[model samples]
Target: MKTFSNRLYSDYLMPSRMTTHEDLIRAAQVAGYTQTSVRDFVATLRGGRDPQHKVLIHRHDIDTDLRTARKLFDLEKKYHIQSSFYFRLSTMDIRLMREIEEYGSEASYHYEELATFAKRNKIKDRADIQRRMPEIRDEFVRNFEWIEQRLGRKLTTVASHGDFANRQLKLNNTEVLADQALRARCGIECETYDQILTDHTDIYISDRPPPQYYHPVTPIDALRRHRRIYLLTHPRQCETNWSANTKDNLHRFYEGLTW
Candidate 1:
């Protein structure tokens, strides 16, 4: 297995890192990820395209930093690529969302309603969560409605924000939207990472882990495999300087704890 140090050194030594976002562009042009947005992927499905093509869905979960999200938007625009940017309601900005949409990208909710409710209400028991399922679903509906109204369109999809800390309590945010009636009422489709795997048989690659850490399949590996790809990245992760990005993310996380 390649170590993180090895990967860091390799990235530092690579020339493609210096020019015009070459590394990512090369991943699409030469490495065969075939950069795609979630909207386009859905359209292809609706149009009944062969699902076996080397499709790559560029998915971004904008957890906190909208500034970095803008930077990423510009980068994708420069390359004539489109992607999906999922924003938490807490971080939703109408102007920024519109700007991203104008760049030919799609916007959707990154939901954590159940987990947020559990934390806010101090609900810890499994039985308590089960009993509150209806309430949780209501909260999701309210939140989805607010976002949809702000976006000025009915949302076509959503993705769950994995609440790792709440997983021990078996309180999954996605579960709140599991009721088909609730989904229909919201007029939205949910696409969690698990669903993406099940639906497309796509290989997943994420830059959430530092570049040094080994992923099950690296971007290069996924490209070589020629499989459908669901590529998730935080905009901060793609910053030109990885070390600086890490430092900023840690600082932001600390600030969030205090805020």
Candidate 2:
């Protein structure tokens, strides 16, 4: 394990700037890209149709922070933009999800059922997970419906969330969605990684790749080159709060010890 001093040094080097995320959103709008939520993006491309204008699909994976989620939510709202927020079960907040929908944005599940199941059952083998696919699918359905029932709206899209178990087990939460029958039964129309959207997407940029936590090319530069783009961010990684970052680092370090 990395020592406490090393962890602190690494955390201090992490780049998290909310203003950078905000700047990208504003730049996309100015560049004539219509920012839309994943739900809206799917609806627009329904029935095998093409979008009439340039589109910027913006989304946030609310990994761990509700405060950061609201900050990003408000920032987009300030510019009259509707984006997507995929909430993990860890950070699920009904009131905030309602607010997102009230303002014309999407608040849907950021599913990690497979990972959750693996950890809970302590099953790490590929065959074990494959054999337990039925139960895994059921877990996903329950979670999906749970969110919808509480949010009081139908979910048109879902984004698969990754976790430590997923990496260790060499599995993805998205595997559950591979069952077309299950997807139809659950009324899921689009996944964040659905090929339909990926085919239309010319490029994908995200506030990922630790420490810096941003794409190499700025959103403005990318917008100048691509007509259809997918922009994803995690508010916790993008927020400009040194104290919150310190807390996050500590939490991660604790998680590492247990894992």
Candidate 3:
């Protein structure tokens, strides 16, 4: 681990203004991202909460590194803010999931069922997978059931994991949720970044880019035009004292092969 850290630090350019735990705190204080969980956001929509009110939905996609995830959860808990965490099956830890839930945060599956199913069945052609929507929907239901049973709670929300490599085929992993019947059967509702943008007049900020390159709406811009905001961050990208670029995340993912 020391060797890997050194290599990353030496090779990759570190950003000067990374989004650390303190940055999150400052954002909350200024009402940059109102403290709200995805579940709460959906509930507000259903209950007809004032749409014009300033609200923020904090979403974390745990693509890899549970340790970093725990760190993030602790940081949010300290601030009395609740956020939603979406987990892939490969990274799912029952104990950690329950602990986060007990901390008042919403937990849901970060699903890539279609992509997983296609790979398992050796179906590389995107058209072939698209034609078998029914099968893909069934796979989604099965995974949902598995996760719910393990978590010992009914999940009302889900978000699709992006399969960027499959983008060339015009395949979106979230398409499985397009089938309303499947959603009803699985007892889950889906949220996508695109849907959030369309449903609310809010500022959308993401930590996908390196901090130096990540220039989100300034506090002034946020306050003037949009009070509601949606912030999507990956736990892998929220590390301290390290570059959270694709190469670093890939290294972490590969290192966790035994996990």
Candidate 4:
């Protein structure tokens, strides 16, 4: 958590070329995601309406989420609901990488760099931590490119896999990263950051990042609290149902939020 805060911020992020994959797929069943599109997404925020909500397209054990995603896509086609699917190269099966591209949904690299670094960097000095940003970014890029070359998928977005507590990376907020992404013509998309608030962008709601494994308020409650929020849910973890070694690290929302 302490190694990522020193960055030039958003230096590597590129504009998300594809529509968010999972949201587009779940949009059919997700009256909320679809509802916003139907209403042009403006009304939700006009009076602080929590409009955007999403399901995580995560693949924990692999296979199941991929197969399920294919089925979900078919259902999406049948239901005429447009959604996006974000796949993690680390978690998703490479065999389905083409499926992700073919689906016309987004393919972003979810870097586990912080998880690896946090375990390694135990020092307590902020200045010392800041020195590690460039190396960390480089490491992430190399790994990102490796995934792209192997998958033959153009990965444009960058998402931190675990909660990053790097006070030195300078990525704790949107303005810093937004300026970087603005310069690079790329940016972070909190498509599903906290669904309860419906405000995924750091600009609208930049509260403290929740501790890993903390579910906090339910999506409905979070949405009630902050109108603009992103809901992060893993298709794979949901199937696991929080089993041992499941690594249910990110925030979670029960089924009722969408229901």
TM-score: model 4 vs. ground truth:
0.48
Each prediction's TM-score versus the true structure? 0.80, 0.89, 0.80, 0.48
TM-score of 3: 0.80
Model 1 agreement with the true structure over 46-107: per-residue lDDT tens digits: 57775675777888888765766777777778778778899987668778888777767888
Over 113-180, each residue of candidate 2 has an lDDT whose tens digit, in order, gives: 88878777778797899899999999999989988999999998999998888898898889999999
For each of the candidates, give the backbone clash count. 0, 0, 0, 35
Candidate 3 wrong stretches, greater than 4 Å: 1-19, 194-197, 211-225, 240-259
lDDT of 3 by residue, 214-256 (tens): 3476433455566776777776555533433555567546533
Each prediction's whole-model lDDT (CA): 0.69, 0.83, 0.71, 0.39
Best by TM-score: 2
State how far residue 149 of model 2 sits from its true place (Å).
Answer: 0.9
RMSD of each: 5.0, 2.7, 5.1, 13.1
Lowest lDDT sum, 10 consecutive residues, model 2, at 6-15
Q: Determine which window of 10 residues in candidate 3 has minimal summed lDDT.
A: 10-19
lDDT of 4 at 35: 14
Candidate 4 C-alpha lDDT tens digits along 1-259: 3423311111122222113333433432443423122112322444576434532222221212454455545544554543344455435656655664565544445555543454356533545544665555555556766777877865544444533444434433122222343324332333233332233332231112212221554433443344333334444322222331133222222211221
